[model samples]
Target: PGGAASNKTYVIYSDNAFPPYEFLDQSTNTYVGIDMDILAAVAKDQGFQYEVKNEGFDASMGAVQAGQADAMIAGMTITDARRETFDFSEPYFEDGQILVVKKDSDAKDLSDLKGKQIAVKTSTQGAAYAESKKDEYDLKLVYYEDSPTMYTALKNGTDDACFEDRMVIQYTIDSENLDLKTVGEVLNPGDYGFAVKKGTNPELIEMFNKGLANIKANGEYDKILEKYGYQS
Candidate 1:
């Protein structure tokens, strides 16, 4: 792997505020999290160098699609819709959507939210999931550009509740000491993958898959997850 192209530093984009996946480390003034650590470990194992841009998730997706960035690993779910535009590496993690509301909320399930507003992040699985249930639940959808703002909307009463990744919302609640809680069962259970524009950088996907397998076998992957309070 010690070749000329291996020395090239690729550009990797990720979300700026999705904690446990990717987020700014204020004390160090740098980005760090599960996705960051996994990318660092995988690049090292596969002998590649990269620079990560902590752009918000939607912007990161656009950057990769527009060829402005080489790849992304923003806890992006691997779905048929995204597959049409991006080539995803083998799944690195599993996740699911969850309904989140304020801790004092008496919402036991989606039925309790009838005619209420639900917040969703733009161009995300959470948004899609909420959209799918909108008419069935007589819900109104409110869009936010990022996770923090979406959660803020829920907390400030701009929206009654929101949909978010199960682990992501849980992590944010614990880390920020927020008064939020998830209700109902997980939905749209799926896996997350590293991605590049379709057919543009198959080599990058290859490297990621290879390094991922190696790390999973050798225990680095589990260590990274456990570092962020996850059990493999």
Candidate 2:
């Protein structure tokens, strides 16, 4: 069943720093992105009123777990550990980890990054992946609170490289006219989904899935992706 008009408050938690996925438009001081657009469409189709809060990614996850937020749409990757903590809707997008470095840098692949300092967001899958191969690559990891900080560190030569979602990193590089290039290939290709508290709200999950399907079928999803320059 849909939510009652009088009881129509649902909050989504997200970290607004991830570009193309979630970010603030400086000109209008409004939050806009593929994630926000998709979620709004889903809520309208499912008959629920909702709002998004720009918080840290880990905090967003915690909010859902604590029932302070109904769900999270923060470009979170589906992982075994996360699944154990929350229920996820069907994947809304496919993403993968990639390395970003100075466009003229000699690094061509992960192997070339041996013994180099790389920046990654703390508590994120990118950090986890880098840590997993820390010993093998003899890598020194620099952790930041968010993507912007990581990018800044990379720009200032505080770090040799930064690892992040390919789509987001690409978007940033182009938008900012940063002289950065994505290295060799994507690691840990994964799906992104909305997350809700585990073992509750089956109806809400069903409604989200239905709405997602409708949006994709009607080409709204593609349009949103293109709006963000994420389309190939």
Candidate 3:
């Protein structure tokens, strides 16, 4: 029932610092990332109105749950826990957790991580994956609210390694020239999706799914992913 000309703007939220996926771009002084671009593309295709809020992940999730935001697309993994509170569209991205260590660290694999500490981002699949393997690896897990801080933990030697999304860690390391390297294979492979408060925004979900299909059919979806260096 809602369209761009209806004068109704849906509030959508994303984490501003999560580069490549969603972050604030200083050159253009605007928010841009895979999630941001996908949302824009979808709105354009579906002819809807929306206001993007580039807040932190926790804040964004809270906003959607509190009914302040109508939806979110922050590279959030589709998990059963999240499904209970939010309705998710078909998965738009494939991602998985990976281990990162200082370039000079001796951590070549999870097997080499005995008695070490690993950094994790709170409330993310990364953190959850770390917890699931911490005991097996004989590791200690340190939590951070954001990625940069957690990455710093590894660089500063405060943490022997970190668990984060493979694409995120790889992109950041190369773009920022971080003194880090990924070891071992990706873990907890899963898909990412756009989400709305459960059972509240059926139309929003419908529009997103429609726009997503259009993009994929028109090759716009692959273009967006390739633009972000997510696809070869």
Q: Which scores greater on lDDT, model 2 or model 3?
A: 3
> Residue 86 deviation, candidate 3, in Å?
1.6
Instruction: Give the Cα lDDT of each candidate.
Output: 0.93, 0.86, 0.87
TM-score between candidate 2 and the true structure: 0.92
Runs off by more than 4 Å, candidate 3: 1-5
Error of 3 at 40 (Å): 0.4
Tell me model 1's lDDT, rounded to 2 decimals.
0.93
lDDT of 3 by residue, 92-159 (tens): 98889888988987778778988788898877898888788888888888888888889898888888
Instruction: Please give, for residues 1-232, the per-residue lDDT of candidate 1 as tens digits.
Output: 4222565789999999998999988899999999999999988888898999988999999999999999999999999999999999999999999999999999987899999999999999999998999999999999999999999998888899999999999999998998899998999999999999999988889899998999899999999999999889
Where does model 2 exceed 4 Å of error?
1-6
lDDT of 1 at 228: 95
lDDT of 2 at 181: 84
Candidate 3 has an lDDT of 0.87
**Per-candidate RMSD, Å:** 1.3, 2.0, 2.0
Span of ten consecutive residues with least summed lDDT in model 3:
1-10
State which candidate has the highest TM-score. Answer: 1
The stretch of ten residues in a row with the least summed lDDT in candidate 1 is 1-10
